[model samples]
Target: MTDCDFLVVGHGIAGATLAYVLRQRGHRVLVYDPGQANSASNVAAGLMNPVAGKRFALTWRGAELLPFAAAFYRELEQRYEQSFFSETPIFKLFSSLEEQNAVLARSADHPWGDFVAGFDTTDPGLPGTHAPFGGAWLQHGGHVAVRELLAALAVEGTRAGWLRRETFDWAQLATSSDGAVYAGQVRARHVICCEGAAAVRNPYFHWLPLTPNQGEVLDVECPGLSSAQVLNRGAYVVPVGGTRFRVGATYRWPPFADGITAVAREELAARLSVITELSFAIVGQQAGVRPAVRDRRPLLGPHPTVPALSFCGGYGSKGVMLAPRLAVLLADWLDGHADIWPDVSLQRYNTLQSVGVA
Candidate 1:
């Protein structure tokens, strides 16, 4: 009997994006952050790149998803009168001649291969390609100023009386046949959990085999670099355009102790040295567990028995590029518009009772 229509857990990117959508749809949302450690979104490099490097495959649903993400962020920028979308080019350094050839060959296969800018220049940087190699240019591959955007939205929501800040204690959550018992607002007809890595702890959906990873990034000072672009060979050095930059998002799987680790910093530092000659100090280090699922796809849909509850998380490292479209689909389903992204929907998993295993 506290208050709220929808009690969204976690204020990270997943929750934030969903909340924004709900608000736009004219629903009340009370987010429960609980003031826990920031999740991956807080410390993410925020690079929304369409072309995946390793597999040389575009992001899953990248064609449709990227446009949604770009438009969504752009709309937010317009509404809030804030500028966070910085369109910069990203240069991917090739590791070997073989990789460069593969990239060039793939470009030939696609008619719109112009997006993949290829260069014959053999030199990229010191400790250059492992073998004779160059790099590929990717347009529309830039970063979101997540920190600034989150802050701006929070302030906007607060002033408009659309948001409340507090820890969401699950013990207080009571589900009825109809909807949910939140604080007092009773704003939403349903509750969606976007709690990132912590979703594993929720009693209702913990069994979903989530593989959480604790990732850390080093905030370094690089004043001289003119081009505000993402440079990658081994580790990515994303320019933040403030004489400061973000580098080395080292991923540590199998859950370890929380907080930044020396090993992670050292590893990141070693990688950063590959591209930059200037010495930079680690001005800041932030750590958060990414909400990763074993399937590597987002977990979406409603709870089996408790139809009033639903969730959308586990986009892993690709949250920036994935969340907007997924949120739209969730909003559509909630608004009774359309059912989409069935692959990651919650309906895929039966309730604990149905499975006979907790």
Candidate 2:
């Protein structure tokens, strides 16, 4: 029977990052991943934007999360001897005069003012682009090649003989105060489900208000759009490589299935045209479901009654930035260093105990 200090289910950013940190801290971790192709982390464009939304409000906890994420990814790069993180600036284009005023107004404040590096009153010199009102250069904004990062982590975990590409069965999982029994064989000190959107199906964590959001993004070849920085207005166009960019990312609610569609493609193309008049060819499209929550905060901490069971999911669209710090918090709590933050704790959901778990 395999035995480990921790058994982590799911291999998305949440799971992979947690495992990476835990392993570095000298703990035995066994990761059981279903290897779902359309998982959110695999399909993410990995944009770590400090300022988001129509109001141009600074992201929740962006000030603290951004620097932590940067340093964490830097450490990962050094550890893995690979480069997947880049500090790419984001130019938030003004959609209207009102929006431009809003940016200026918000930039005059505390947190918002702190992140705005400068404003571009005139076009930032991108040919065939429409930025008459200009935009703001956001500080601490960047991109993480999330897919590459996950792959590297998986490779390292597998090479260390701690990762298994298999679906975990809850039916065989039995928890006690000290540890957990998985598949009637594997013994683990704790079991953390980081199953992303699939966590909604987890009997242990199904009660959490996880709203699965379907998002689609396109990869395009735009030779004329040579700006290296990310451009965001109605849509975001991020330069991933030479003459290639990651674009689109339309959000759909009811239709939570992970599948590409013509409507999303058309909407993305139209949005791209609005961002730039340059002709571009669509290279490909990818879609995935984000594990968002009702309050839009992460869901972490242990099951109220089941001490050996825990969870780390529902990071929504901000997983890239949120994972590192949140993982540290979860790992520290597990090791008895501290308690999970009140906002992110599963204890906030009073009805979880009522839903019942086997």
RMSD of each: 2.8, 1.7
What is the model-wide C-alpha lDDT for candidate 1?
0.75
Locate the minimum summed-lDDT window of 10 residues in model 1.
123-132
- Report the Cα lDDT for residue 78, model 1: 94
Tens digit of lDDT per residue, candidate 2, span 1-358? 8989999998999999999889889998999997776788998999999999977788988889999999999998998899989998888888877778877776666557467889987777766578988888898879999999898988877787888989998878999989999978899999999999888788777888898899999999998885668888778888888889999688889655549999999999999998898899999999999998989899999987788999998899999999999999999999999999999999888575676531
Candidate 1 ranges beyond 4 A from true positions = 1-4, 111-114, 124-132, 183-188, 351-353, 356-358
TM-score of every model versus the real structure: 0.91, 0.97
Best by lDDT: 2
Q: So what's the TM-score on candidate 1? A: 0.91
CA RMSD (A), model 1: 2.8
